[model samples]
Target: MKNTVLITGSSTGFGAAAANYFAAKGWNVIASMRDTSKDKQLNKQENIFVTHLDVEDTASIDAAITAGLARFGKIDVVINNAGYGLFGIFESFTKEAIQQQFAVNLFGAMDVAKAILPHFRAQQSGVLINVSSGAGVVGFPNASIYNASKFALEGWSEGLRYELAAIGIKVRIVEPGGATQTDFLQRVWGEGKNASIIPDYIPFLQKSEEMYANLGANSDEDAVEKIVAALYAAATADDDQLRYAPTSDIQPLLNVRRSSSEEEFNSFTNGLFLGK
Candidate 1:
């Protein structure tokens, strides 16, 4: 029998790409999103089933899992790809916005992993892949909350891998650099309550935006493809590989982060953000 995989946030971007990739590879795919009605293409595929799954909603998460099992018999892999980015000055964010960022990015991913662990343990074989970000490894301006959430996810996944290894379940994190093709930038939530009107922040925000625009312009054209490839690697890898950095653009930055001292790394990143 073909292996079954359940992926969250399948309505677009990496989640959608991964759904197609896995189904084409002959795996049964449960392509889940917040609104099933929005699924116009994925459901048309024979091996891909579209379902509703709101990561912030436990009931929806449970329902999606149950539905996937009913359709595919068992879930051999669970990809936690549901999340959004929060961008703005750290001080501009409201308590609610910060909480929401953690809710969807960190806690939501954890809940999905928790929900699937029982099934995985019973089967003695499963893969749990969390879609993290380059920000998880190194911080970037205007993404304080996003970085925090992904950093937490990276650490959490690292720890969980050890606990799950004895039971034959594997945990992995796939960190992609900016995926310009996705709606990620468009969907990023700005800080709460008149943040844009704050004059003192305008010039800095403009510089940040310009820097991001430049990065997007220089981004790898095949970024999504690389990310999907990484996900495939994480799902199929036999040996224990904990982290996969798949984007070409960010590899150099990651290297600098690893090779340079903390002060040097800070200087390097500061130059990028400050447009020095």
Candidate 2:
């Protein structure tokens, strides 16, 4: 039987790309978004089912899972990719923005996992592939809030991995460095608390975005395909890795951070800020 996978936030970017990638590979792809009506592309694919899934809403999540299970017969893997970035100074971020970010990035993912856990547990087999960022491993300037969300996801996945492994449910975290075309940067929300005033960290944000916008020397399709492949491996491999660093920049930096001393890592990161 062909495996069926559900990917959240499939209306665009990595999620959309991965949906097509997996569908073409013969997996039944549930290309889910908060508003399926907006996803004309996914609706056209015979192997793909575009469904409505709002991670922030419990009812929507449950309904989406039900609808997905009904249409696909079974959900073998879930790609929790429904998240956005909230950029700007941490201090400038208002309570609302911080809450909203956590709602979508951390809690939303947890909620989806919960909604699917029962089915996975019953079947004694499933995979949860979380779309964390390189920021999930380490922090950068002016992205404390976004970093916090990804860090929380890393923490959750680390614990959940061991907890579910014995039960045949596997989990993995994907740490992609940068993909400029995503709505992640353009749709960035600034916390109203201190943004209008412009904190000293504003330059760091500008520099980071400027440097990031220059990445992906070739087509991002290669990167997205790598992520989809990693997700597939994480789902099917008996002895799966807990983390998959899918970008060129992310893996090297992860290696350095893992091997370097705290002082050395900090010094290197400081240089990045100084643009050295």
* Model 2 TM-score relative to the real fold: 0.89
RMSD to truth, every model: 2.3, 2.9
Output the worst ten-in-a-row residue range by lDDT, candidate 1: 185-194
Query: Which regions of candidate 2 are displaced past 4 Å?
Result: 179-194, 199-221
Q: For residues 151-208, what per-residue lDDT tens digits would candidate 2 score against the true structure?
A: 9999999999898988989898888877463442333334333344444655565577
- TM-score, predicted candidate 1 vs. hidden true structure: 0.94
Which pairs, if any, clash in model 1?
A: none
User: Mind giving the per-residue lDDT tens digits that candidate 1 earns over 1-276?
Assistant: 889999999999999999999998999999999988878799999999999999999999999999999999999999999998787677766788889989999999999998989999898899999999999998987788889999999999999899999889999999999825334233333523413445677677666766777777868888899999899989999999999999987888889998999999989988988856
* Superposition error at 110 for model 1 (Å): 0.6
lDDT of all the models against the reference? 0.87, 0.81
